[model samples]
Target: MNITVVGTGYVGLVTGIAFAEVGHEVICLDVDEIKVAKLRQGNTPIYEPGLESYLIRNIEANRLAFTTVPTQAFAEADVIFIAVGTPERKDGSADLSYIEAACRTVAEEIRHSTVVVIKSTVPVGTNECLETMMNTISLHSIHVVSVPEFLREGQALSDTFQADRIVIGAQDAHSSELVRSIYEPFERPIFLTDRRSAELIKYGANAFLATKISFINEIANLCDELGANVDDVASGMGMDQRIGRSFLRAGIGYGGSCFPKDTKALVQIAGDVTHDFKLLKSVIEVNNTQRHRLVAMAKAHFGSLIGLRVAVLGLSFKPNTDDMREAASLVIIDELLESGAHVVAYDPVAQSQAKRILSPTVEYANSVTEAIDQADACLLVTEWDEIVDTPVDVYCKLMKNPVLFDGRNCYSLDEVKQSTLTYYSIGRNDIIHAYT
Candidate 1:
């Protein structure tokens, strides 16, 4: 199959590369000339695990290409995927302008009858609306299908190839089969539904996962007050077959591309129809408050953050990606800076990206050791492998005060019990250094 993927962001790039890996000829189109140029030269603009290697392999095999010329790419393709971003609006609704623009380009450039797949995460009924828009604009018969992507950022490649199931939402049998054929090589279970249900499934899935995160974080917060261990509580609860654990880890909150946007969009989607999603609303409130948990802990310990030297261990929302969209570290660091705390931050891959989003007042350190050097306290925001794997005693040895506030609960109580650092983590009893 000759496939043209519109937009070379995380979703588009991963989808295009995944298809090429499965022996399809794929061309990724983006408006950014510099990004397209970098991709064409075997460079990936985003930091996703195993993406650059797959991109280079497919490009070397001549199965994949990158381009800024959408007409050329769209005209010669059997399938065109609208994989652009649908960012959140101020009102919490999904901003579908990008999807609309991609559809307009497809309507204008498509030369033949093609299977147009809406792979971007869009609001319900968007695919049907897009189908109507395309038919009104173009003389060519186009089959529009809703095939929402379920790839996580850091593990996009693995998730794409190893997805538990694929959802194909199309009005016609031909469109369903065409979309199915694209993923048949992966041999995953395929669920066929109407366009609206498929769109709802994407948002619904994300909302549910966000609910789990918020639920667990609330439980963790309760545990913190009651002198209980959330790890043991989560483990006990997850042992039930009905509640299989995935997002049950007690952490500050979820901060990535999907959960924050999708949850808010889902709430807005309900509100548009006059249904007040009260539960999801509280979930959002809990998550917002959770980001400030670490900062609160720091303030409680020291009484004042004015003129304090604080070390932030990680910047990315989660590990293995440089994306800082909705990252907890950003919220925490901003709050710290506002409170007059001197912040030193470090991330293995996200330093440059973080620098762009974070305040210039933040001091970027080259490594974990450098970031924590002579700091009054250390705040672990993102649980990167480098930050998690560092020796627990290093904090005590380097920090002037040896106080540690762990937002992600990166270290175990057992590990901190052996160290002289005063450790405060979510859902765990504070481990105070006898000397401190």
Candidate 2:
């Protein structure tokens, strides 16, 4: 199967490479010639584990190729994937400029009776709009299909190969068959539906996940106020078969490319139809508020953070990826600096991107221990492995007041009990303020 994937972003590159790995001939297209050149030379623009190696292997094996010319790539391809970016607009709607542009390009470029699949996350009715646009543009039959990707950043490769399910949406049975054939190698259960449902499914999934994070964060706050341990509360609730355990961990809220934008877009879309999605609206509100929860907690610990040296452990939204799109660490860093606290941060892979965003305003530490040593207090914003495993006593020996605020609850109360320092975390109420 010869597949042409447009837009060499995270989704496009990952999707293209994964297909090529499974013995499909793939030509990855990008408008940016520089990016195409870099990808051709085996230089991945993003930091996804196993992606670079996989891309290199496929490229070396002649299964995967990169180019800026979509028409040239799409000429021989049976499946053309529109994996472009649909960045969020200021009004909280998904800006479909890239999607429109990609569809137009595919419509004009496609020579065969091709299936143009939308792999990008778009609002409902987007696939229908593309199908109409393509029909108007081409004399030959071009079927537009909505095939939304559910790939997580760090585990994208594994997720794509072993996807829980594949959603294939098309207007007619012919287009749907072509879409399924393209994904036949995946061996996953395929959910065949109308285009609108497929589009809504992507948004719905992200919004629900975001809502869960917000709900737990709200619970974490309540625990903090009522002197209850959120960890136990979460555990107790998760034991129920209904809740089961993913995305229930209360932390500094979700901050990634998908959740923040998708939740906002869904809320705006609902408002357009005069439907008030109050729950989703609150989900966004709760997540935005949760970002600053650590800041408020920090302020409470030290009356005025002015001139205080604060250490921020972890800079990425979540661990295992170097994407800082909507990372909570950015909010925490800004708040700390705003309150006149000097912020030192560390992340294994995201430090370079963090440096670009954070710049000289905050100090970038070489390692987790380096960030925490001699700081007035430390906040574990993102629960990275290195930060979680750091010795709590190290801060006890180095800082004037060894205080630890566990935003992700990376440390147990018992672990911090032995140290001659202050420990505050979400939900566990047993460890009261030993000092003050």
Candidate 3:
């Protein structure tokens, strides 16, 4: 199969590469000339484990290519995947302008019958609307299917090949089967549904996962109040087959490309139909509030952060990815900046990206020890192995004053207990507040 993937973001890049890995001829199309040039030379613009290696390998095998020319990408395609970004609007709805542009480009480029798959996360009814637009504008018969992607940034390629299920949404059997054949090589379960259900499935899955994260954070809050450990609470709750343990690990909050954007979109989706989604609303509220938990802990410890030198251990939304979209670090660091704390952040792979988003006053560090060295306090934001695996005693040894505020609960109680460092973590009874 010759597959043309339009857009070289996380989803598109991974999807195109994964298909090429499975013996399909794949061309990834992007508007950015520099990015296309880099990708052609086997340099991926984004970081995902084993993706660049796969890109290099597939290009070497003559199965993968990158291009900025729309006609060239579309001319040789058995199917086209619109994996462009649908950024969030201020009103909590998904802005479909990118997908609209991609569809328009598809209309202008493709010359024959094409199976157009919508791999971008879009609102329901979007695929149908796009199909109508394509048919009306183009001479070619256009079949738009919704096969929304669910790739986590850190584990993108692995998730693509090892996904539990592959969903195909199309009106006609031909387009649906063609889409299925693309994923059949992976041997994952293929779920065939109409366009709307498949679109809803993506949003619904992300919204539910966000709800789980918010729910656990709420439990963690209660644990803080009742002096009960959230870890034990989550463990007890997750043992139930009904409430399995996936997003049960409580932390500051979930912030990446999907959860924050999709949950808000889901809420907006319900509100558009005059139905209020109160639970998900609270979930968003809880997550927004969760980022401030560490800051609140900081204020409680020190009456004023007017001139404190604080070391932030991680910057990316999570480990293994440089993406900081809606990251908890953004919120936390913003609050810290406003409070007059001098912040030095350290992330192995994200510092370069974080520098663009963080305040100019915020400093960058090469390593965990460098970030924590001579700082007054430390906050563990992302649970990067570089930050977590560092000895807990390093904080006591390096910091001018060893005050650790752990947002992700990266270190065990035993690890911090033996150290003279003042440790404060979420929903844990083992906080050593040695700083009176």
Tens digits of per-residue lDDT for model 3, 304-338: 88899999988899999999999999999999999
Worst 10 residues of 1 by lDDT: 427-436
What TM-score, over all chains together, does every model reach? 0.98, 0.97, 0.98
Cα displacement (Å) at residue 332, model 1: 0.6
Error of 2 at 46 (Å): 0.6
For candidate 1, write residues 277-369 as lDDT tens digits.
Answer: 999999999999999989998998899999999999888888999989999998999999999999999999999998788899999899999
TM-score of 1: 0.98
- Model 1 Cα shift for residue 113 (angstroms): 1.7
Clashing pairs in 3: none
Which should have the higher lDDT, number 2 or number 3? 3
- Candidate 3 lands at a TM-score of 0.98
Could you tally the backbone clashes for each prediction? 0, 3, 0
Work out candidate 1's RMSD over C-alphas: 1.6
